[model samples]
Target chain A: MNTKILRVNMERLTAEFEELPDAYRSLGGRGLTSAIVAAEVPPECHPLGPRNKLVLAPGIVTGTSAPSSGRLSVGGKSPLTGGIKESNVGSRFAQTLARLGIRAIIVEGQFKEGYKLLAVGKAGAELVDASQWIGQGLYASFERLEEAFRDRVDICGAGVVAEMSARNSGLAFNDLEGRSTRYAGRGGLGAVMASRGLKFIVLDGDGAPGVEVEDKEVFDRGRRKLAEGLKAHDVTKPGGALASYGTNVLINVMNEAGGLPHRNFSSGQDPRAEEVSGERKAELIQKRGGVRPHACHPGCIIQCSEVWTREDGADPMGVLEYESVWALGPNCGIYDLDTIGELNRACNDLGLDTIETGNTLAVVMEGGLLEFGDGAGALRLLEEVRRGTPTGRLLMHGAAFAGTALGVTRVPVVKGQAMPAYDPRAVKGIGIAYATSPMGADHTAGYSIAPEILGVGGKVDPLDPDKGALLRGLQRATAFIDSAGYCLFTAFAVLDFPEALEGMVETVGGVLGTPLTVDDVDAIGKKILDAERTFNAAAGFTQTDDRLPEFMHLETLPPHGHVFDVPAEELDAVLRDG
Target chain B: MMEAPSVTVRLFARLREAAGTSEIALQAQDIRGLLDALVAKAPSVGSELLEADGQLRQAVTVMVNGRNIEFLGGLDTPLRGGDTVAVFPVVAGG
Candidate 1:
């Protein structure tokens, strides 16, 4: 798998492809992005300044025929959290970049004037002045790009909010259908792109030299086993839970566990939450003629993405993921799916992350901007962000900043970024993930939910506080998966089937022509974590930084009536001291 | 006349579709009796919940109140009237 790094200097508007360095040979996805950012970007530089750089890389097996392996990692210093971030997304853009033999795209320097589009193709990459796309909504911007480049091209671009340098902005990637729906939506990576004066990265795959496998026989063996495991598993199998209802399936599950945050993390459960659940959403999709069991990218056997539509099936909104639903729905005391669906669409259009925007809106509600459960009111507020109102600017900076502005003390954030749907007080294990994750308040930090992973013998209590080591191992393994380019949903099958794990390890080995065994998963993942941790340390994050918000420690959540009680020492040991 | 001792058996996701109802009022004193009542109310739910070996299906997650039943003694976990038993075919997501 030979590849080169494509570096774009916005100051000069120059595009150059450099030979892939030996140090970055085995790295891909989060591993590669974090490495590039940590090595090249200054920790203290303003995230929206010239010194900050945005790096995008596909996972090691991203472009290959590996099942569900089309994930791209977009990393940079987050303006929101003042920490390193790698926001992952599933899109054809990743495969297109990987197919072009471009391992990473390092965007450097600031473009002071207007937005430009970076077009990469068989003819080699070039910069095109795209100032017209600067202020347009992403959906329209993406449509124009599709028209300009035609159907064969995939797109990655900053949204309108990102053009305004909103901290809550996320980079939108065109999904399989050319819709600007999929997002590397966690950190403020979009603003980082926008800051560099690059609005879009379009990849034309026609006549491209696709990803070459070093060992086809080994790769095929690994792919088959992984596919079989996914096909057989209950959650990932054809027409299974995820495929049937999409990711919003977790709405009811988390609510049942008393871990679902409702009304700005004030409570843990509400009967109204059922109105926005996956079960309810799937029924609505069926009645309205929308598509469930949709794949964000090709070769995704899990196919958990969906196209959410209006009552008459008119205006399709893509994939109401669990976190997005929760953050915009019950967490704001709004139970209507149509309302949440509209909010989701607005976020996609403006290039705002649904999670951060939702959390910020909740804080806005608490601050007396609007009453809770006001769906119409929430939409109007989102309009403010698009219109660049004074209030909207405050909201777009994200939850922590919004909370401070709003004077709300019940902010549910870790390291400036808002926590997702799960109330950490109820599910202590995931809370540890939120607290200790280098990316800050990320639920995806620990994807290993296996019984064996949780504990060797028994059904370990989720409320148990001694889960630091458990989370360390889980996060380590997850880092490898994120770097490998496999969808995190792949963990559902791999957790239950041993062979699936072997398949993942062997596939990477086949791609890189190096033997990586199951025993190496931890060490390899740890390497990525270590780099991120070191960068964060250099960025001035300390032991106190590795904690759930102070509000979590003081406030007891309802239903479970528990607080986040994991010891600081436990969290401290997660990195495995040198 | 007073209602018989009952626990609310709530279903979610595909489980509710199979059972034909989201909530079922079932007379029971423990998790085992609750299963019997659930089967009596919706045999489809029973088929989806248990295997031929009479063990709970691996995918099915049962919780009494908010605590997972698997951690509490599986089938033998005691239940009282007015307790809420939530069931879902466990699907992993963030």
Candidate 2:
């Protein structure tokens, strides 16, 4: 098997291929990216400085025919969190890179000169001058790149937002339609890529060797078992919850649970939230001639993505995720999908993380920059980011930086990273995950909301403050799935069906030619998380950093009148001994 | 006579589509009765919400006044007049 680690030295403008070390042979996706970042990058180095490195890797089963398994992990020291971070995304970009016989791509060192594009093909890899592409929005930049490169090439890059080295910029990957929408959209990894002076990484897999699977029959068996579970489950099956409504289904679900954060995390519920819901989105999509139940990548059966469009069916914005919708919608007091869709369009164009962008706007509004619920004002503020104005810089540094600058008291963040759509007070289990995740308040790090609020895995009290052990188990298992590169939505089925979990293990085992049972998930996942934790600890993070904002504890959210009352000891318990 | 705890039932996602409306009102004293009334009113959605043995399907998530029935009293949780009851097929997303 060709396990080649491609090392790109930006300062030298050189690309070299190296044999993957035995230590990294078994790791892939988040596991591999975090492993490389922990090993090669200095703990104390400035995130945007010369010493920092960006690592991108496809998950173990990413390139295979495994269903819904096309997640790419982008890892680096985060300028936003000042911790080791792995931002994950789903797109054809991952499958293309993996098929080229590449195990991982390590982008290292800074390039003071203008940006360069790294092109990898069956022939060889080379760096081309990409100065002209710099300072352009991702929409225009991706369009031009598509025209410049062959149709087979999958394009990925940091957009204009990254040119300013903003803390909220994400690395944008092309979706199935060649739109620059899919993203590793958290932890300011795009700024790290920008700092490396690399605007784009284009992978052309034409005529290249595909993924190497050691045991074909075993892989097929596992894939079949998983496919059956997905096909049978109410949430993952076709015409089921996810396929019918897309992930925006959660807008109503979370709102009903009183877990949906509104207006900068001040309240948990908003009657207006249903206005931008997945159900509503689906109806509009049908009426406006947009595509629903769409896949972000090939081989994805869940299809929890959609093409949101204008009422007249003119401009097509990519998927409005539950997080994106809530972040840009009710969280900003803007109920209209058009306003939120435009906000999402701006985020995609600028290559900024929508979750961070929404929270920044909320904090900015709370600081008196605009009134709460000002959708027009929110639209105007994004222009500042394009212009790279002083206010825009503050917004791009993420919610914590903006909240601090504005002296806003209720900055809802953990480790300088803003919280997502779910409020911890209403959905207590996810709050624990938020506080303890190595990635800084990322819901995907440990989504206990499945059990806590949605009743997917198993029913649990959303108000319960005693989930330390449960959160730990969830976080560990999540690390494994993220490493496997399965869309996290697969967890909806995997949780309810034991066969699916076993099937997941077998798929990875089949790919690597190793014997992996369901029993091995915890230890394997823990090893990956241990690497990230060790890096964070070395970078000066303490147990104190693993805590929700003080306001969560002090203030009670309405509707449910719940506060985040999980004990400090419990939060500490989740991350320790990992 | 006074109304039999006239609670409003809100459906979501698949349930709403199946029922052909987002909200419905019915008189029921407890969650079990409300669900029974719900099925009687919207049999298409009712078939999805209840199992063969008449137990609430595992996929159905029920919350009353923004609180899950699990924390309150499960199927027997009482409904009062003017209360809002939310139900769905337990969709999952981060």
Candidate 3:
């Protein structure tokens, strides 16, 4: 089976398949997405303009029976950050696309005529007019699509926020149960899709040309080795920390370490943190007869995903990840899981990135638009977005815009993107990552919380200032992992198990029909980072754009009473060698 | 016959759930003595926190006065009255 690039030109309403370019043959996922965006898209072009191409690509190992290797990268210039952006999400849509012998789908030009949906299958692909589905939430649109096309196909699309051209909008992908909860939910890529007048993309391939492995013997060997490592590790193993409680497990741990951001970064520790803790959440789910230890995609050994249900076990609100919980819960001074769950559902329905929206709400609360810890007020704020009210439109533009509009100087953001769960003031290494990563305050960009707080990779003092090198190394390694299509959670096992890391690298080699050493893996990651950084540089991003918000340096966080003290020189050193 | 000093022992995550309280006041002179008193006070938490050989479990991170015990003296880290001891199970998330 030969991999092909599927190009959909909304300008001409034509679908064309091109042979994979030799330069892009070896690249997959973020590597391919960033490479295509940098090479084809003019950096100085408006992010939501026709010149900004949106590229979606699956990882190298996707569509294979690789554990947790189902992540898809969506790349484009970000309206939010005004730099290169590669937002990733885990969904079967990526695996299905890979199985169809498609390496990447590049959506270019603009469809000024009307809204349309691009459908791809075993036979071919087509662009169908979809104006009827306009102005509807993603859930209603998806339900209608599934009813019309049958439920077997995987669907991905933008929601109402995209229609409104909200900078904080994100693309949503249907989960295993057809809930549009999984999202490549950052960097305003949804608005980019909306700019092209593409409402949704559906994959309905009946007889997919499955992924071809060059060396089955080597692939099987490496696959088993990696799977064993996942099973052996306490964190990734079945019924372990992740499986049992999901990512929300970090609530109490971060609260205990005084790294969990609370009340809009005013404090680190929240006395009511346990109310939304993983243990309590899991208990509540079990009591409500909801499903636990769930996998987001097929062939995933680490079933870290779960279904959160209402009191009567009706209306499953999708998987509640740690970042969403923290962003909606303690960040806004609300601890009730029901409130967070409702807010999460609202974000998913409206197609707003939860992290950005949560941060935006906190900023508005700080600006005195609403009282902190007011769950009802927060729900009403989300309603304002659904109604497309003027205030909702402002809030939907994300934390930076809302902060600027309200004259609130305490916005916790870097390069326009809001930071995630871990407060950088306390978790110093992550602060370096937040400041330096091209993705703008993305925890998954480096994830120093593993070493600093969780003690996974190696123990780093959470308060240490001398972690520039560590953050840089983690960023390099993570770039490779993202390009390879493995879930970031797999790092917990790969870092501790040498053989697991080797097996993962070897599996890629087996799939590509080439011999790759550990050195090659590092090169691939560095190459991706270089491409991203070069694109951002050409887009006019300087060292100043790579720094955290000014208030982080001025205000000290509570509990530990620490400020983000990582030197500017150290932040600049992150990608210098690359 | 010296009076036993009281240290505030803080539990987080699953440990707090197991102990049914976030903080516990225990009488002990040092870190080891504190653990013994803690296990005696909450028998259900002993297996979760300590191994059969009486060593702290690998998943349990113990900190004395906001400093990791590994940086200080491990289980031998001395604690004075009114010192805060925080214990947590190794947890992670993105």
The digit string of per-residue lDDT tens for model 1 on A197-313 reads: 999999998988989888888888898999999898887888887788888877887787787899899999898888888888889999999998799888889899889888899
lDDT of 1 at A14: 97
**Taking the candidates in order, what DockQ does each have?**
0.55, 0.79, 0.53
lDDT of 3 by residue, B1-76 (tens): 8887888998866677788997999988778888989989888888888889988877577878667777678778
Worst 10 residues of 2 chain A by lDDT: A569-578
- Worst 10-residue lDDT window for candidate 2 chain B reads B85-94
lDDT of 2 by residue, A1-578 (tens): 44999999998889999999999888899999999998899999999999999999999998899999989989999999999999999999899888888889999988888999999998879999998997888878887888898775798899898989999999999878788889899999999999999999999889879899998888888999899999999888887778788878888888887778888888888888888988888999999999988999999888888898888998788888889998888888899999999999999999999999999999998999999899999998999989998877878889999999999999999999999999999888989999999999999988888888888888888888999988898999999998988989899999999998888889999999888999999998888888899999999999999999999999999877889999999888886754
State residue A397's C-alpha deviation in candidate 3, in Å. 0.8
What 10-residue stretch in candidate 1 chain A is worst by lDDT? Answer: A448-457
Candidate number with the higher DockQ (2 or 3):
2
User: By lDDT, who's the top model here?
Assistant: 2
lDDT of 1 at A457: 19
TM-score of chain A of each: 0.98, 0.99, 0.99
What are the runs in model 3 whose C-alpha is more than 4 Å off? B12-24, B40-47, B50-54
Give the candidate order by descending DockQ: 2, 1, 3
- lDDT by candidate, in order shown: 0.87, 0.89, 0.89
